[model samples]
Target: MNKALLMCLLILPGHAIALVIDSSKPIEISANMVVIDERKNISTYIGKASITQGSLILNAEIIQLFSNQQSVIKIIAKGTHKQLAHYQQNQPNQSRFIEARALNITYLIEQELVHLKGKAHLVQGFDSFSGGTLDYDIKNDKIITSMSKDGTQRVRFKIKL
Candidate 1:
């Protein structure tokens, strides 16, 4: 399989992390269009899907969620999707720990991994990283980001404490 394809599969719903809350019901979504396939246990929101989970916020032009199984198995996102993963640290101030964006994104619940393709970018406070493609293992807190190796292009980043 292609690297991009592998990354996508790794981040699909059933492949990522165990759900912290199973009773969490679906909330209302306002978008241009929405479709739910009960037979497949899949829900698709298009033309802008905004999902909020506690401090986490996600925005995507299209989002496909698999919810039929005991666990959420796969998530396919496309078109300018952005994610903000926030939390409260030891400090008094709330922290936006991580923000990410991509043309397409996928999360595998069982694998606890996230894959971002096409102009992927990630920001964490003063530190920021960007690449043509990215793969993040959320459970292990590992990230692999890369750009085309050709000499005609350049990839730049900035990090500050």
Candidate 2:
């Protein structure tokens, strides 16, 4: 297998794959509104913010992450979401991947799944995938995506990997 794919499989826990982010520096973010509810202990960053964690980069107009008394429970990102690009490197190999755009995304930590609504698309090498609503189970390497109520004009892909 390719090094990136192998790394994804090796670093992943059980069936979960690792979304790696490799950068020389931390991601810089600028936002209009950043709210932290000390009472509830939830923090939200809104209005044109970007986040980079390892090899993954996410940009959205609004990104909200909720945490309970202990840990983060949910993360919701919306408004013109997109992935700039990604790169991976391993022993004697390297590769790059990119995504065009993402609409609305909700991540449920407890459920270990990421839900993407609206126009979502993923691109890798010469292959591409687009769908209206997509649900990915990070823990199981499974994807359950479907079209909206807009008839057959929409595309969907459901895979259990």
Candidate 3:
């Protein structure tokens, strides 16, 4: 769908406070197809869905947004194993960016948390982390990872000094 129309559907009231880091920035989104279910307060984007706001960008095969009348509640992105969903954002006061990939990514807007599952990997500047699951607390600037349920995959981290 066109970015302008998509922005209208997803725009929050100017007076309402957004949960994202860059709340004041304008958001732009594009996709091959979009389905909005007003009854359920959900909007689903199919095909190559991409959402961008300032330096933050997210892309996936499908992206779903759950929202209320005032603001977005959550966002979910899904991608196949071969092409994992991607999320990236520039860090404040830093030239480097944080990039992440996973088969499924869920962003809890109000909680300021991002959950990544299945082949989850994240990189911030020169540091990298990979695990079966990754939970990022955006407000706290912290990450927690867990091993795969089968216990075959362990969390790994690489730090460059």
Candidate 4:
């Protein structure tokens, strides 16, 4: 993703093996249009919304950022018309780029958890996982995936030895 549109919440990508976020670093955002509702405590970026923080990048049709007085709290991103929202990172310490895609992606900043839903797919180096919903808990380095309620979906995993 290009420079994103909101400054507070920084979203990331990949493995159940947590990727660290340098929270001290500044956040940059760029989008076609951005809206900030100070009263509602929300910032919305529409049309080609992109977010960047250090080496991390996230792109979506719309990105909704929520914040409190002290810090950014949450980030919600959505793809357009059944497309996939995406995120990627390739820092020097990393062996390769880690990427994720989903129709909807949400990050809970304080908890350091990411929830990917609607055709979720995540790849860390050569390892990968795909499912209807994926929950990545950064702190504990755990991933939980599940099928859709209708049971019409399935989860897949490809882990490298």
Name the top TM-score candidate: 3
Cα lDDT of candidate 3 equals: 0.81
In candidate 1, what are the lDDT values of residues 29-124, reduced to their tens digit? Answer: 345776766577676777767655433455788877786455457777777425422111111121545567787778776686778777777765
Q: Against the unseen true structure, what C-alpha lDDT does each candidate score?
A: 0.58, 0.53, 0.81, 0.73
Ordering by TM-score: 3, 4, 1, 2
lDDT of 4 by residue, 10-107 (tens): 33222211235433455667788877776777788899898777666789999987766555678889996566899776534447776789999998
Could you give candidate 3's per-residue lDDT for residues 57-93 as a string of tens digits? Answer: 8899999988787777788999898899999877663
- RMSD to the hidden true structure, all candidates: 9.3, 10.5, 2.9, 5.6
Candidate 1 runs further than 4 Å off: 1-28, 80-95, 148-154
The window of 10 residues in a row where model 2 has the poorest summed lDDT is 84-93
In TM-score terms, candidate 2 sits at 0.62
Q: lDDT of candidate 4?
A: 0.73
